[model samples]
Target: MQNFGLCLVIKQELKPIPLQNVVVEANIVDMIAEVTISQIYKNIEKDTIEALYKFPIYEAAAICEFEAEIGGQRKVKGIVKESKEAAKEYTEEVQKGHGAYLLESESKDIFQCSVGNITSGQTVVIKITYVTELNHDSESENIRFVLPTNIAPRYGSSEYSSSSNEGKILNPDVVSYSSKANYYLDLTVTCRMTSTIQNIESPSHKISTEMNIDENPKISKITLTEQITYLEKIFILVVKSKDLDQPRAFVEYNPETQTNCIISYNKKTFIYTALTSQEILTIQQVARVKSTNISTNTWINTLEAFRHDLQLPGKIEDIDTKEELECQLVLFFVSCKQQNGKDYSVQSIKTARFAIACHINLYSKIRPQDINNKNVYPDLYNAITGKIKILTKSGFGESRGADAFTESEIQLIVNHPAMQTDSPKGLLRRIFWHNAFEFALRGGEHYDLKIQHFVKRKDGGIDVIFYQSKCNQIRLSNSNPKSEIISISPNENIIKDYELYFTKRPPQCDDAFYLQSCNQAEVEFTGYWYKSAHVGRNSLNKFMNEIALVTGINCDDRKFSNHSGRKTFVQYSKSRGISDNDVMSVSRHKNPHSLSYYERPKTVLQQNTLTQINDIIYKKRVVTNEAKNQSTSFTAALEFYKGSISENCKFKALAYLNYHIAYYIIENNISPLPLSEKPRVPFQEIKDSQNIQLDEDCIKKFLQGNTFNNCNITFNMNQ
Candidate 1:
């Protein structure tokens, strides 16, 4: 009843306020921090063994099952149009790599010669009963051919293969076979071959870093009166000497251990002391003591005794008098408070005193050798050293700093490779952007942000703050709190050649077409763009185009849209892993998934690939002992092992079955020690069977809500 009355009284006193989304005029201070990044993409290569070994000069070549477009001189009636095109395309392709050359490039004659054909013969009558259109759902086309000739050709494995086989070329335009007239051979045969479209991509990236969040930002209540508990008023004779040649002098007021009490030499005696670890109290822990200083000394309590550790100290400079030493010992006490919510806290208090002079080391220059506080990680040195500090009194963790080039650079880069493109402005933005992004990306997915931003930092640079969102609705997916900012330049270095290459102008807009025109484009920070050499920032326009292309989002203007992709991508990626914060800092968010968004589709080719895999695996789920004699990647061992799955593959049963076989072989065989990674087949790779007809009664029954596993039967556990 008392609680009820109290709640009723509180309800009358509490008042609610409405929030107005007003356009408050406030400048957003940004602290720019920078890190230089150099990205170099290298191409990896794989070896291939061609099949001309079976077929001699007149030997039967490839047996393919792909479509052939027949574009003959005339309309070859029964032959399909694709068949004719395939014939012509094959002929042209075979003629490409048929000549014999010397093996050495330096040879007067031909150093190397091309002798075999990938496509050796053509049907007198083209009959491509099976034709397949190029599918954009997969990485490559699905098609296979036979190399029957037994002739061995010299193989040069290079990412760039200059030597082309003379057989039919299976290019994007056409799949064909080329055959020379065999005077003695006139056998009628159709190469019944198989093929498939396979995908090749790099693996996902993996990285980790030291943790940042800790209680060091909490407030302490230490007091000034409670400062040095043992203040001394020992009476002693005073003396001073101005001459550098003459030594300073002093005498101890009372008898004490000679070493601990004073330093006497050349008529000068010096006294030095600090609150011993036990003598000093933090207001919260004053009752915990077990030392002799607490009992014996009365007038001016002796300094507290603490732990013993030693370092060879740099000798104190020569002081002319005891007064000079007295001038150096002035001390101060500091403290703060936390309201309620938190259960624990840590501080970044100023812990040491030293005169600022050439001989004195500032916290900034205090080398690691001078530090004994190893509990703090190397990264927190600046924080502990007071080079940087936390100030949250006004609420949302704001920081400031003052020569601000580093801050500017950080901002410039942040806006890039995302907003600005690699262009000058974008480049600068990226340099700074990295710092803020790097900090946020580290928060991980479980983070719940309130407000995080970066503005002017102490270096006359940028400062960053991160917090949980205050928005009521889920406008954005980011939920992490505890963010950071920095100060620095955005670009690693300036690259002006891109601008000059396009002649000093942004491209002019085609008033009639509303499109920007760049006939002679130049590649700059913003990327490759060509505008009227006399007009605008061509690079900016190109950046816009790339942004739209890479992302489906449209920008209001080309420049605006072009530059915002990187920034916006941050939002999207933050939603993906939450823990991907660190990776995002490096601008490496879209790799493995990029393949999924851009894929090809062609069924026959896919079937051919499956067929090849099946053949390689033999009749068992696992590669049999027979398959072991094949090859390593395509090993007798791998016979049970089907090839790897695509990078962004979603899981399913067909893929499961294929990989299951491979798994069994590894589990039971002696080819290797570890199990192979199971394949992940993409449900996205499969085209929707929208056109399939269904019985009306059956459809009605299904629509009435029969139990089904999400309607993707291929995903059914049992094939």
Candidate 2:
């Protein structure tokens, strides 16, 4: 087997730069601003290349329009649709070698734009328009407008990027920070104020201001003095006006929707009101829509129904009393239904309640603090806690975590015909299963494992080291305290499987540990089991399920996913009386409470415990001679092996002996071998029958003067 010690060497390459220029134009009126950002991309490479740009937007901003001009001729406008549908369309266009543009929201503040199939020397311009409210100082008459330019690296996995359409939207090329783009940013802002403008300045950059006071004293324009600036920092401009302390109200009529919206601002408090020809309603009431797809939009629909019943707007300012809020929540929880028009399950209801609590907490943070009390939503906060007791009593919360595999199920899986086969796929399955169960690896963690992570130890065991995982992404210090190292004892069967698999692995394959298998005919002819392609993520995730199906196990009643291996390891270790800290060392769990979630007992173990308790209570406890003998014999064997085996071959000899002893007991349907004063060959039958090879001198030395029950048996050495 090839030895890959610790680190992997990655070749450094020059990253590509496709973004050329960015221009921003903004028009501000009082507290609201409408901005347009234009990004230009050019393909300077000889062949066609896709350009992907990730940028930041204000969290509260609402994107209004997106348009693109490909090669400065063809104009394409973006349409709002479901994410999956839009991704499908973009993929189809890219597959046809045609120009396509896609703008998607990665998070509340992060956005990604892709220009696909940009031919050589082609220039594409993308424009995005959005409207946002200016940040106003509570104590001063100044309003601040901010335009985000740089998107900082985020830590967790993106919820949007983890969907089914991830492959189509997420490009690894866009994630590189080494690329330096030859680009310039130009920004122009035109501000219109209701009161007289006192001053306009930028604290972040040098800016030039122009006032058309002669034509209209309320209008002012601001621009960057340098004209050429890099997109490295946020652009902020503060506008101070006189006599801005008075309350103000503005109404805008939308002819398209035939509705009038009134915005009232007074002392940092804003109230939105909607007016129609028939009656006046709150903004939430007017925006409410009866959604037909209840499954995906249950949270929103439930909130809308609650507000409609009480004639309350979505804003926290519209809510008056604690009693009213509690009543509204009670109504929502009782009336909410699933997609099939049935009441939600206990878990689903709990999830919905969590979503509502998150909304309340968010509003409390953003709402202005009162002079009398610092807590903004005391009533609402109290309501959330008060309802929990009632909800729990109604059986609204229950946890149904992933199920662990039983001992019999594990035996069936490892001894299945597919696992024992000599084909390439079979070998891959064996390695995958063993690694997952032994190391307690999470599902997605297997996707990034490389050949370099495995290191051979001096004790003849293998140590699998993990440098990074989902729980530990950022390493703050030089010490690798968080890295998990799992040691595999030197077992004959396991070592042989690994050696054969490595020998048959294709040389063209990269450093990825897992590879997809080639056809059986190709493997037979070329002696290569796997091709150059790495295994697909979906295949790795469903590997355990495939094994269950082949073993004729029903998966409908219980979940047997890739996570089952991890759960099984935890449960099995606990059954063997392993300490929590010892298990945590192998599992690499930082929290003891998190480890408890995987410690569910199997039905058989639960029944055995109950029976033991009953026997003790009834004074019918009977300790069998076979049980005592089995325990004593195993303990004595362990001590004997520890004292007799040589330092160089201790691990291998002990593992081989233990495996054969278990096999002997199971084959003969008898009790464990007992230690005796006379010599005997406990594994003589296995030694003569099995075709496995081992060191002859080491075996002879170990059995030369060993005593076992006075039954002497001949030993055969096979090469």
Candidate 3:
């Protein structure tokens, strides 16, 4: 009666605060947490009045349960329904003068609860329950559990607030003003961990803890030191445990839903580990069979690539379901490409599958039973067998490794006009070529070569120490040294070439082995031959094309490339009868089979075999002297143009003429022009013709079958 009289006395001056008290209870098992909050409200007004309150909660928490108790006797259970339908029902009930409770989300991290048709002096209780996974602190091994208790006042226009209808709810005119009402908060947290709990602390408020260390699964209870505290800030609880890195798994079964949810925490990431020991062993067995023996980094990178290809989220938890995992795997297998923008090779695809399978086994909730079930992931299984296996059988997207350079081709490249070592460009070209060949360097390996990597031996030889390579990813030099030491003999000309190039290296250049070539005249004057800028990868990769252009070796085939040097080294070693072990040591190949792929018959043997096969098949058809002597007109034309034009120009002119004549015969469906009908424009007339310009435009016209006017030349068979 005293409280009612006091409320009535205050009602004339100001509205009573509806929120009376809040009690929070939380239970944590391993990394998963379940929290329940109860908020009490009282209506002190005379007539029926609505009570509304806004609250904050963890953004990641899933609200699983809600209930309301009105007038301390009637109970109402909340059901998850569409927001609009729920709102409509609540509004209809309120309009009928009946009590209605409505709880809705205001934002991701905020919620609103409204109790309508509350009689004077009536009490209402609201309960909300949610579950979330605790976050792992990146700075330490502690697990963090956060419960937001306060919603700070927003300063800007409420219309722009993230919550829907926030402007009407938070309007200053509609909200009744009152002094800061005295409210009390009570919180208790119970933690159960697989490992022993080392410590428990709270940063937001003072907390007292009760620990039980001797339990098999250690238990701890935490409570606020002050029994009644204001809801002014967020509450935070941090738990540190012994053996935190050890893998742990927990399973929760819902009897009504007839479903199970598993949570596994291992190595700072969450995964589902509901399998028995035997099932885990079975997964390991399958992993061994499908594994590509790649490094851990390579496996991780392959999984990342698969995720990127499928446009999936990076977090494993988001894609841990069976359907999502299966769909992503199928898409990745079908559409993923290599770094070169080409379809992945059969072996590479298999490796990717292996990596993805391992990732699923390690991080996803898709159980082994689901994976092994034929009907569950049919498309994924079919993709693995039909697409990948068919590709393997057909040898689709397989690389026919680069062709090796022959002895004569190598000689041509070394002696070509552009290979002169007098200029900076020429010297760089020479050094790059020799280093790639002599060291069996793969493409892009020379880009990181440094002067410090080339160590001079006491015997006047040089040792090229590779700190890292494709096989040796970790650059640890001590304890488990994987660096390859390649020795260059003192007698090799490449040693002298290296010495000369380094002698002219500029002082401003860094430790990079390859330097940009500068102007020849500038190099001579400044005595600094190369620029300080490091040679780009484009220049290094184009060296083979440059060599091919100048020497005309395999220029038409275009089969030789930067990787040709490594292939050449292997083939050259085999031709010299070098043992497999010796060759593998220099090539840094772990498998002899890899080296055998580069082995082919010697050039002489290949030619001889082809000739022998042809002789046996066709019986060596003999040629008549008339057929052999069919070059009379060609010789006469060459002699006719002699001393009139340069030899190079004369050859080019005759070649162009022959090509056009052949094209004309094909286009007209006529026989070749007879020797007697060949046009013989005198050299003096060709030289004196003003219309016959030997420029690029004239050459283009000639190639296009344009005729010369003053020279009296026409490709007309009838004339």
RMSD in Å for all candidates: 50.1, 30.0, 26.7
Compose the digit string of candidate 3's lDDT tens values, residues 228-343.
Answer: 54534446789997666667887889999999988776756454569999998886654332223443337567557767755767754347567777776676667676678766
* Clash total of candidate 2: 2
CA error at residue 357 for candidate 3, angstroms: 6.3
Clashes of each: 149, 2, 0
Q: In model 2, which regions exceed 4 Å deviation?
A: 1-396, 456-461, 475-482, 508-512, 521-527, 554-556, 591-594, 600-719
Q: Which candidate ranks first by TM-score, i.e. highest?
A: 3
TM-score of 1: 0.15
| lDDT (C-alpha) at residue 420 in model 3 | 68
Q: List model 2 lDDT by residue over 1-719, tens digit each.
A: 11100111125222345456778899998888999978665666787777664555566778889888878888999888898888999999999988887788877655666677777787777788888777676567788887754321221123433322112232121222214755556789999999888899998788999986458879999988875535344467999987566778779899999999999977544534666845644443333222212232567566776567667766433455554555566666666665577555566655666555544543543333331221744554454445555556766556566678888888988898887747777788888888778888987788889988988778777888897775665444536546767888888777777777778888778788898888978878877888878888878878888777877766788988777889999989987678989888888888788887898756755765665566557845454344355445545655555575465556544654575556334322343244444333333344423332335344444343342343333333222
Which residue pairs does candidate 3 place in steric collision? Answer: none
TM-score rank order: 3, 2, 1
| TM-score against native, each model | 0.15, 0.38, 0.40
Runs in model 1 with CA error above 4 Å?
1-572, 578-719
* Residue 116 lDDT (model 2): 78
The model with the greatest lDDT is 3
